[model samples]
Target: MKVIIIEDERPAYEKLVHFLKRYSDQTEVIGAAQSVQEAVDVLQQKGQQADLLLMDIQLADGLSFAALDQVPLKKPVIFITAYNQYALEAFRANGIDYLLKPLTYDAFSSSIDKLKQLSGTFSDPLQSIQDIYKKLSKPQYKERFLVKIGDHIHSVPTEQIQLFFAEGRNTYLVNGAGRRMITDYKLETIEEMISPEQFFRVNRSYIMSLTGIKDVLVYSNSRLKINPSFDFKEEIIVSREKVAPFKEWFGGGI
Candidate 1:
């Protein structure tokens, strides 16, 4: 089997290589990339020679999905990531298996075995992957959050939320009623739990809801400033890198 590895961490890459060798002496690693840009370049140049791709979701530059958006890969992929939240996205991108890191030999072997079995059984590899994806259940996003207020508990529906923001080390949720409540979940966790159609992470500090947005003004440095329905002390500005995606999300393209 000829494979390509896309991983940023050195130890993880070395461990993966060791496991591949243990799986079969005939298994050959044809290419390796450490970042999204490198992965794109490598895939464009040597992708045809690779029979399989072993990729990490997070890379040095950005997420591996960014590379997939730029390059069209036909080979089956096995995704390795520390976070389980990316499993749905992984499966959508020609993935046969999604393995969480701190990878075990048994897990690695099983994924390889499954790949071989499926390859031998199905003549159309892409169709097989699509069938497997259809069999897997879809991700269920959070519908409501339970917040404690002194002696009382409040169940806040996700649709009522205007935004989620991080202040210092703590995260807070703002509802449509202009009430602020502390949440245990970090902004990163909140980003994964909410429906993408309704919310977007504008910057590192803020995730804004579509219905809550009052105005979008062109800001300095090619960024965008967001005015929400509720009062917020700090300005909500979309990061320069995220500007394009934010626009797409706002336009319902994402």
Candidate 2:
């Protein structure tokens, strides 16, 4: 996947590059632009050379939405924004997923998967952007879950889960009451089932609830550490690259 990142902030761009290298090795970042006009020029010049676009809503020149009006971008786009207000505009303008500032690997990877799915169905690429949006917009996510415990099967509700964590190869669920139980599904499998508005995947091993985050502490490495309400032995640290989006999600970005 050849991607073009359009972000004005130096740190945010660097952070995304870092995570992309670690998680998404298959994706090659072909180019980057710091402003709206630059992005327009780059996209117009590259045309079909670029397979995907990671665009920022606010650019040095102006809104990215306005910039796209000046040129035709056929590649699938995944929007990046510091605020939630621009999300609606992104969707209308061929966006696959709106990643709030401080993009996490989980969210980024999920968006990539969505883009792949969209590409598989549509032949004209962005021509079916609106169609892809309408198809994926209303998905039937998992509402309730069934958990099995030694000889006794227990049912768990999505609202009660504080977070889902994977250890070694097994996935576990930490409920509202701080009880840990083994789950049959993996983190990747459950990630698709839950609503993004309520749960944010801060790292590879954990997908946490907005309500369960007790405190957000700045780590020594400049990343943010999530202090969950539950008694989790594993440290939950949101990488420096993902801290911004995590904060936005925590603040109710949706």
* Model 2 lDDT tens row, 1-254: 77788889998888778867776678788888898878878877774687888788988879988767887665678788777666567766777777765577887777777777766344554554554455446655688888888899998988999999988978989998888888999999999899999899998888999888889888987788989987777799997777888888888887
Which residue pairs of candidate 2 clash? 101-245, 102-245
Question: Model 2, 198: alpha-carbon shift in Å?
Answer: 16
Which ten-residue region of model 1 has the weakest summed lDDT? 128-137
RMSD, one per candidate, in order: 10.2, 14.0
The Cα error of candidate 1 at residue 70, in Å, is 1.1
The C-alpha TM-scores of every prediction are 0.50, 0.48
Q: Among all windows of ten consecutive residues in candidate 2, which has the lowest summed lDDT?
A: 120-129
lDDT of 1 at 233: 70
Model 2, position 206: C-alpha lDDT score: 87
Question: Where is model 2 more than 4 Å wrong at Cα?
Answer: 120-254
Candidate 1 yields a Cα-based lDDT of 0.87
- The candidate that achieves the highest lDDT relative to the unseen native structure: 1
Can you give the lDDT of residue 128 in candidate 2? 46
